[model samples]
Target chain A: MSPVSFFKCLADDTRLHCVLLLQHKGELCVCDLVDAIGESQPKVSRHLAQLRECGILLTRREGQWMYYRLNPQLPAWAAAVIGQAAEGNSVYLKPALVRLGKSESQASCCD
Target chain B: MSPVSFFKCLADDTRLHCVLLLQHKGELCVCDLVDAIGESQPKVSRHLAQLRECGILLTRREGQWMYYRLNPQLPAWAAAVIGQAAEGNSVYLKPALVRLGKSESQASCCD
Candidate 1:
């Protein structure tokens, strides 16, 4: 996909958060994202759908749960963008990561 | 600036082209961008203004011309992201660069 479409996928607050969380955690289920982002399940799901539609994210199904991760096939530059976004704005993302970590510490739904 | 804002700024066709050109050419003036992207001067200027407002680009004024380049202060990852975008999508951007090159080959207004 073109870089414009790739970046357009990441322009939203919810979508950007989902991508950042996936990048940070490697993989997460919808519930994991919901807990981490403190947004409703449907809201999180909608953003995930947008990311998926743009081909930036890939999904896998495990029984009743859906797991999400950054598309491994994403061009190097796209990953670099996401990586830099995560790094340059850690202060904004730390809380979400911390929350996801805590949720995983308690119990990961993906397991 | 936050990653969302940064990406939002680039999500536009015009703005993204301006940035890709700036990244490819190192620096370009408003007229150079207008010629390279084949857009009107006002539209190019507007996108350049948006990019500047978001801090992704820095400008220098020389006489009647203002030159623009990627913000040097951009985090390494951000630069890498732009670099990768330019690299991964050269096919999409080649024509614009060629046009810009041709324009320069003839005569550079910035000179």
Candidate 2:
């Protein structure tokens, strides 16, 4: 993807959070992101669809659940940009991560 | 700046080109970007103002010219993102670079 397109995909709060969470967690379902980011399922799903359309993310289906992850085929530079953002901004993601942990401990999503 | 804000600053083609150009060139005047990107001067200056407001760029004034460059104090991750985009996407900026080179050789801008 072009740099503008890639950056545009991450310009929104929901989309950037979702991408960073996936960068950290390897893979997550739509429900997991909704819980982690405290956004409605539809909103999170919409942003995920945008990211997928931009080719920044890849999806997999297992039964009724869909999982998303950073596209492995992303150019090394693009991946590096995501990695740098994810690695350098842990505090920014802390609350979402806490919510994710609590949700995981309480009940698994997409089960 | 937050990743969302930072990415937002680069989400547009004009702004992204101006930024990537500055990242590669170290510093440039508004007229230089106008010539390099083939955009109207006001449009290039407007985007540069946005980037400066977002703290992604710093400006210096000399005589009648204002030069812009990536903010040196920018967080490492943000700088890395710019560097990676600038380096990995040379072809995207090729025409602009050629324009910049020709303009420089013909007559320096803001002279």
Instruction: Give per-model CA RMSD.
Output: 1.8, 0.9
Candidate fnat values, all: 0.82, 0.78
TM-score of chain A of each: 0.92, 0.97
lDDT computed for candidate 2 = 0.92
Candidate 1's TM-score reads 0.92
Candidate 1 ranges beyond 4 A from true positions: A107-111, B108-111
- What TM-score does chain A of model 2 get? 0.97
Computed on C-alphas against the true complex, the DockQ of each candidate is 0.70, 0.85
Give the per-residue Cα lDDT of candidate 2 at A96. 99
Q: What is model 1's DockQ versus the real complex?
A: 0.70
lDDT of 2 at A58: 96
Clashing residue pairs in candidate 1 (N, C-alpha, C atoms within 3 angstroms): none
Please give, for residues A1-111, the per-residue lDDT of candidate 2 as tens digits.
Answer: 788898898899999999999999999999999999999999999999999998999999999999999999999989999999898889999999999999999868877
